[model samples]
Structure formats: structure tokens, C-alpha cells
Target: MRAIVVERTGGPEVLAPADRADPVPGPGEVVIDVAAAGVNFIDIYHRSGHYKMPLPFTPGIEAAGTVTAVGPDVTGLSAGDLVASSDVRGAYAERAVIDADRAVPVPAALSAEDAAAAMLQGMTAHYLTHSTYAVQPGDTVLVHAAAGGMGLLLTQYVKLLGGRVIGTVSTPDKERLAREAGADEIVGYAGCAAAVRELTGGEGVPVVYDGVGKATFEDSLAALRRRGTLALYGAASGPVPPFDPARLAPSGSLFLTRPTLVHHIATREELTTRATDVLTRIARGELRLHIGRRYRLADARTAHEDLAGRRTTGKLLLLP
Candidate 1:
């Protein structure tokens, strides 16, 4: 099997392509021939050592493919099953193993690439809107990086829940993409807080979905209404520095939370529910997936560089 191996943690240059023996499933696990692996910010964090991992590991957690082997204690799945998982083990390879329970059945209406593209970011958007700070109808919410993969999903999900979205984008191209995804208003990073205030008639929004951490944390706080919530999910630019909790009091009793997808999908039932909703929506065209680019398995280094440099938009996938 061919895989991208990280023997050391540093820059994207450290992601080296190498040949490895095929993976075999362990108890309660299933092995799949990976068709596409989702390239995400989490993968970048793992490669850069921002998120610690054991040395000499493959650096992907989400992929979609056809099951070729099923291990002991696994049920309701068999060889030749089409599955995708957000919890794949060493997913940056031609073959990988994952727990059977973590695997989600991909709809026949969807392609393997789209399934891979949708899992992590799609479920994150689902939980952020439906669980973390449930958006009520008529509520106005702010979404940062509203042109990126997660941003587009958040914007569309908010609109589906009957809320208006005020999105922040860096470029005109991004602004157009955000608007196409149903963003009610698009503003540049500069003076975004003031723009949100003016757009909301000085009342601000009920919640701000911030994925671009550090760079946009203060603006996100400033754009919130009284008793609003700030769901800080990702740090695309960089991680935010530690701060005093008392800062929330002056921001009208604001709520700040840093949530992850693993907690929301801790149980197999919860994972299924969220994954099903996202995949079904995509299959029915209610949710649109933009696969910005695809690269060969050996080009994982380039993929990481492009993503970390913010040189691409939408979902990026590595095809093996």
C-alpha cells in the first residue's frame, strides 16, 4: 500500500510518501480500499504537531471507500460494503482500517469522493448549528470564513433553520461564494464588527460561528448580541491565546465555547444520526459539496501546503 508517512512533526515538507504493507482489520474493525480521503485543518494540526500524535503515523482521520475485509465482532457489515468514516485510522493510504461502528453507509446516490468530502466538515456544521447553539428561526448569526468549506455548510444550514447569516470573507470571490450559499450579508474582515452591528441595527446577532480562530476571535465577540453565543470551532489562521473569562461579562453575558466533532458524535447512534442527515441532504441536492481540488496520494505534501496557506477553497481530497 502507498501512504503518506510522517516520521517527524514540522512543516508540510515532512509528509513523505512511502510504500507500506496493507492494513489488516483488528477486532471490531473493518478494512477498506480508500477511494478518497478528506484533507482537513485537523490533519494539518496533526502534521504540524499542534495536535499531538504518536511518532511515525499516517495523518488523516476521514475517508470513503469500499470495505474489503471485516474483522471479528463486527456486525451488519461485510466485504464489498460501501462505507465512509470520520474516524478512520491512518486514512492517508490506499487501504485503512476503522472501527465498524464509526463507519457510515454512503448513499448510492452519492459518489465516494463527495462522501469523503462531506463527513468531517458536514457533521461539524450539523452539530454546531443543531446542538452547540441551536439556531432559532428569525435569529441572525455570524459565520467567519463564510466562503470556505465549513463556512459554506454553516451558511446553508443556518438558512435551512430559518435564520439569517452574516458572513465574513476575505476576497470578492469568497464573498460571491458565501452569497451563493445563502449568506444574507457578506463583509470583509476589516471593520466586520461594525458592519455586523450596522446590519443588525446595532443589536448584533444571537450567535457567531467562528472557525477562523485567533485572527477573528475579538471581532466575533464584538458582533454578538446580548446573551449571545460564540462557537469557536477551528483555528484556521492560528490558535487563540488564553484570556480571562471575565471578558464575557462586559460582552453582555456572552457564551464562549470551543467544540469538537468527536464529542457530538461520541455514540454510534449520534454519529449515525448526524452523518445520515448530512449525506441524505447531499444526495437530495439540499446540500451542495464543492470539491475544490483532488490530488494523487503521493502529493499529500502539496495538499497540506495549499490548505495551510489558504490557497484553496471548499473541500480538498486525496485520491488513492
Candidate 2:
């Protein structure tokens, strides 16, 4: 089997293609023939050592494919079953192993590429809107990087919950994409807080979903209504610099949280529910997945380069 191995942490050049032995399932695990693997920022974090992983490992967390082998103690799943999974590692290869319980059945209406695209980002968006803030009807919210992969999903889900979306993007093209995804208002990075305030009639939004981290953390606080919540989920630009808690007091007495998808889906049941909800929505067309780019497994380096350069939008996938 072919895989992209991160021999050391540094730049995109570290993701070297190599031939390796095919994976086999262990007890309670299944080996899947990888059809499509989702390329996420988390993978970059790992490859760059921002989020540490042991040296010389495969660097993917989400994928969808047909089951080729099932291990002992795994029930209700067998070879030839179509499945998708998030929270699994080693997906940047022709075949990957995941615990059977962690894999969810993919609906016939969705293709493997779309299924792979929907799992990680979709579930993250799900927990953010449903659990983190629980957006209310008619409530206004701010979403940063609104044309990016997670941003697009977050915008759509916020709209589905009947909340008004105020999105921020880097360019006019992205602004248009965010608006098409249901953003009630769009603004660039500069003066974003003022824009949000103006859009909300100067009261500010009740919640701010910020993924751009260092680039917009302070502005995110400034754009929130009194007692509003700020869910800081990603550090796409860079990690936010440390600051005094005293700042939050004047920033509308705001509530702040740093969330990761793993903590939200810590249990098997939670994982199943979130994955099922996101995938079912995609299957039924309630959610639209934008696959911004696709690359061959051997071209993983180029994929990382484009992602790091901010040259792509929406979900990126690697085909095995």
C-alpha cells in the first residue's frame, strides 16, 4: 500500500510518499480500502508539529471507503460494507484501520468523496452550533473565515437553525461564497467588529464563531453582544497570543471557550449521533458540501502546499 509519511515535522516537503505493508484489522477494528481522505488543517498541524504526533506516521483523521476486512469482536459489520469515520488516524493511505464502533454506515445517496468530506468538518460544525452555543432563531452571530471549509458548514448550519449569519472573508470571491451559503452580511478582516456591530444595529451578535484565531480573536470579542459566547475552534492563521482575563470583563462580560471535535464526541454514542446527523443531512441535501479540490494520494504534498498558502476554499480530498 502507498502512504504519505511524515518522517519529521516542518514544511509540506516532509509529507513523503512511500510504499508500505497493507494494514490489517485488529480486535474490534476494521481495515478499509480508502476511497477518499479528507484533507484538514488538523493534518497540517500534525505535519507541522503544531499538534504533536510521534515522528514517522500517517497524517489523516477522516476518510470513507468499503470495508475489506473485519476483525474479531466486531459485530454488525463485515467485508464489503460502505463506511465513513472521523477521529481515526492513518487515513492518508490506500487502506486504513479504525475501530468498528467508530465507523458509521454511509448512505447510498452519497458518494465516498462527499462522505469523506462531510464527516470531520460537518460534525465539528454540528457540535459548535448544537452544543457550544445552541443558536436561537433570529439571533445574530459572527463567523470568521466564512468561505473556508469549516466556515461554509458553520454558516449553513447557523442559517438552518434560523440564526442570522454575519460572515468574514478575505476576498470578494469568498465574500460572495459566504453570502451564497446564507450569510446575512459579509465583511473583510479590516473593521470586522464594526461591521458586525453595524449589521446587528450596534448591539453586536449574540455569538461569535471564530476559527481564524490570532488574526481575529480580539475582534471576535469586540463583535459579541453582552454576555455573548465566543467559540474559538481553530487557529488557521496562528495560535492566539496569551492575554489577561481582565479583557473579557469589558468585552461585554463575554463567555469564551476553546473547543475541539474530539472532546465533543468523546463517547461512542456521541460520535454516532453527531456523525449520523451530519451525514444524513448531506444524504438528504439539507447541507451542501463544497469539495474545493481533489488530488491523487501521491500529490499530498501539493495539497498541503495549497492549503497552507490559502489558495483553496471548502473541503480538500485525496483520492487513493
User: What's the number of clashes in each of the models?
Assistant: 0, 0
Per-prediction TM-score to the true structure, in the order listed: 0.99, 0.98
Report the Cα lDDT for residue 277, model 2. 89
lDDT of 2 by residue, 34-126 (tens): 999999999999999998898889999999999999999999898999899986669999999999888999988999999999999999999
In model 2, where is the ten-residue run with the lowest total lDDT?
243-252
Model 1 per-residue lDDT tens digits across residues 40-135: 999999999999999999999999999999999999999999999999999899999999999999999999999999999999999999999999
* Ten contiguous residues minimizing lDDT sum, candidate 1: 304-313
